[model samples]
Target: MILSRLSIINFKNIAQADLSFSPNINCFLGNNGMGKTNLLDAIYYLSFCKSYSHIADSQIIRHDEDFFMLQGYYDNNGNEEEVYCGMKKRQKKQFKRNKKEYGRLSDHIGFIPLVMVSPSDSDLILGGSDERRRFLDLVISQFDKNYLDTLIRYNKALAQRNALLKQEIKDAALYEIWEEQMSVTGEEIFKQRKSFLSTFIPVFQEFYTYISGGNESVGLSYRSHHEHGELFAQLAEVRERDRILGYTTRGSHKDELEMTLGEYPMKRIGSQGQNKTFLIALKLAQFDFLNRNGFTSPILLLDDIFDKLDSQRMERIISLVSEERFGQIFITDTNREYLDEIIRKTGHDFHLYQVIQGNIESLKEEK
Candidate 1:
């Protein structure tokens, strides 16, 4: 899948712009707060129907603007596809495919599979368990459409159970109903997550090895209550305890993906560069996984990811994506030197743009 064109209006700092892209690479150059990252986020919104950093939809609209719009033209295999999104303050956002509105936004997710690696990815290690689980869900949601529906069902059940707990309901039968639902849906999610990680871990490790030259070994392990023998039984056992805490304590929502460097927790031991390397490798592996599983290679988005890396690591990343398997890429950077070196190393057709404030102009393109 290739995003051949993108049109935006009142999105973050971008006032209005329509631009084309190179099938190979499209690079954006700008300083901090110059709207480079927002441009990438616009493309990300087109794919995932949300922003990479997870801000409120209203906040994404340009200041003093009541509404925003984004449209993308894509080439999927031999078929042409058009995606459109429009939002207004205090109103529902409309998403359409080929100009026909979608009844459910979830249906549009995997249709344009994409993998984004941004500086915010550091949250995976530095942040809490929720961050890692989100990474898991985002990757799986792209390849498995029904996974999101299952997750939604599980969350609803968990919420109901929690609400009952908070209300101090004396009804054991009500508790049984939601607990049973949670067990069923949560177990399915657990199985799929486990299955995805079984194949994902090795690919992640391989990418890390190549990027870091195997100087240090990294590892990821899944932690879940499901392995404790039946989510239903565990939830029943924790029922009384959950009532005391006013929340359901045992479910997939509490599962975690632990990150490690050389057998120790990455959060405590990893230096800045090491942590960044870990995230970049992880995202590249995500791209690889979606490429192998999806109908076409997924688009790659890199948001200010070249900030802290050394020259060798950057070159390895450039070389890896330059290969044929990875498709269209959108990259944002503050340094011209890094983008220039990428152009030289990849030797692929590309478009380079300069972003100033909220405006974007095509500075150059190699046809």
Candidate 2:
């Protein structure tokens, strides 16, 4: 799918803009805080129904603005798809396709598959287990709607079980109700997660090898309690412990994706460049996985990720994306030289835009 055009109003710092995009590559150039990333976020919203940076919809509206609106025109397998999203202060956000609003926002996911690589992705390496679990969820959810729905049900059951544990007078019957539900749903999620990683790890490793020139070895290990025993038994065994902690202590929610550099934790051993390279490779692998599974070619978004990388690694990434396997890329960077190099190397259809304080102008076009 290609986001061929975008319309934005009062979203973050972008006051208003109407822009067209190339199907192959589109580049946005500007300094930090110039709304370059915000432009990309607007595109992301059309796909995911939420901001990539901000958790709250109201927070992303322009200061003092009543609301924000975003719309995208997509070419999905040669069929035109119009996606519309709008939000008002203190009201539920609206997301629609072809002028009809979605009854449930999750329904919109995977319609326009997208993979984003940004500086914030370093969190996958340095942040908590939740971050890693989210990475798995995001990629898997894009291709498998059943997995996403099961995850939602699992989380809901987990939440209810935790609430029961927190109650002063917990009923064993009620606890079992949620625990049973959690166990069933959690098991499905665990199987899906494990099954996904089995196929995903090699792809991830391949990209890492290509990016790092096979100079360093990396590893990804998925750890979960499901491997030990059934989730129902685990939850029952930990009932006392969970009550004491005021939360469920054992489940798929605690699953971790351990990143390693030569058998050691990357967090403690890898340098800045290594860490960045690891994240870029992971995202690209996700793109490849999604494309191969069912999404044809997921849209790729690169947000200010060129920093802290050696020239060779940077060139390798540019070369990789320039290939025909990738499709409909959107990139944001402060350096024109990098964008220029990409254009010179790919020789594919591209459009460059300059962003200044939420304003945008077409810089060049080679179609």
Candidate 3:
């Protein structure tokens, strides 16, 4: 899939702009706070129907502006596909495909599979387990609609069960209802997650090896309560403890995707470069996985990710993606030299743009 054109209006710091994109690589060059990342986020929003950093829709709109709009023209396997997103303060957000608005936003996912690697992704390593769980969900959801729906149902049931736990009555019968639902849905989620990781971990390790030059050994492991026994039995055993804790304690929500360097946890032992390398490898693995499963290469987004890496590592990454295995890519960086080097190395068609205080201008096109 290729994003051939992008049009933005009142989206974050970008006030008004309409730009075409190359099928191979598109680079945004600018300094910090100059809206380079914001431009990439706009493309992300078109794919996922939400901002990567911002939580509230209203916050994404340009300050002092009432609304924001984003549109993308894509070429999917020779067919023209257009995605449109519009939002207003104190109003509902609208998403459309080929000009027809979708009734549910979840339907838009997987239609345009994309992988984004940014400095913020370090949260997966340094942050809590919830961050890692989100990583798993985002990757799986793009390929498996059933897995996405099961996750939604599982969360709803877990919420209901937690709400019951907070009540004074503590009706066993009511608790059993949600518990049974949780067990069924949670079991499905656990199985899918387990199966996915079994396939994913090897790919992740491969990328890590290539990017890190095979000097450091890395590992990824999945941990879940399902391995002990049936989720129903486990939840039942934890019922009393959960009641006291006022939450559901035994479920897929607590699963962990542990990252390791050699035998120790990467978070504790790895340096800044190692951690960044780990994350970039994980994301590139995600791109490879999705491209293989989805039957088309997912658009790749690299958000200021070249920082803090040695020249050798950067060259390895560039060489990896410049191959025919990858598809259209969008990258952001503060240094023009790096972008120039990448453009020259790839020797592919590319478009370079300069971003300044929310305004964008096409710098040049390399053929």
Model 1, 1-367: lDDT tens per residue?
Answer: 9998899999999999999999998999988899998999999999889998899999999999999999999998978999999999999999999899999998988999999888889999999999999999999999898899999899999889999999999688999999999999999999999999999999999999999988999999999999989988998898999999999888999999999999799999999888999999999989989989988889999888877878788888878877877778888888888788778877889999999998998889886
TM-score per candidate? 0.98, 0.99, 0.98
Cα error, residue 236 of model 1, in Å, equals 1.1
How many backbone clashes does every candidate have?
Answer: 0, 0, 0
Across 191-229, the per-residue lDDT of candidate 3 in tens digits comes to 888898888889988998998899999999989888888
For model 1, what is the C-alpha lDDT against the true structure? 0.92
List where candidate 3 sits over 4 angstroms from the true fold: none
lDDT of 2 at 167: 86
Score each candidate by Cα lDDT: 0.92, 0.91, 0.90
Instruction: Tell me the TM-score of model 1.
Output: 0.98
**lDDT, residue 39, candidate 2:** 92
Candidate 3 least-lDDT 10 residues: 164-173
TM-score of candidate 2 versus the correct structure, residues matched by position: 0.99
- The positional error of residue 301 in candidate 1, measured at the CA in angstroms, is 0.5
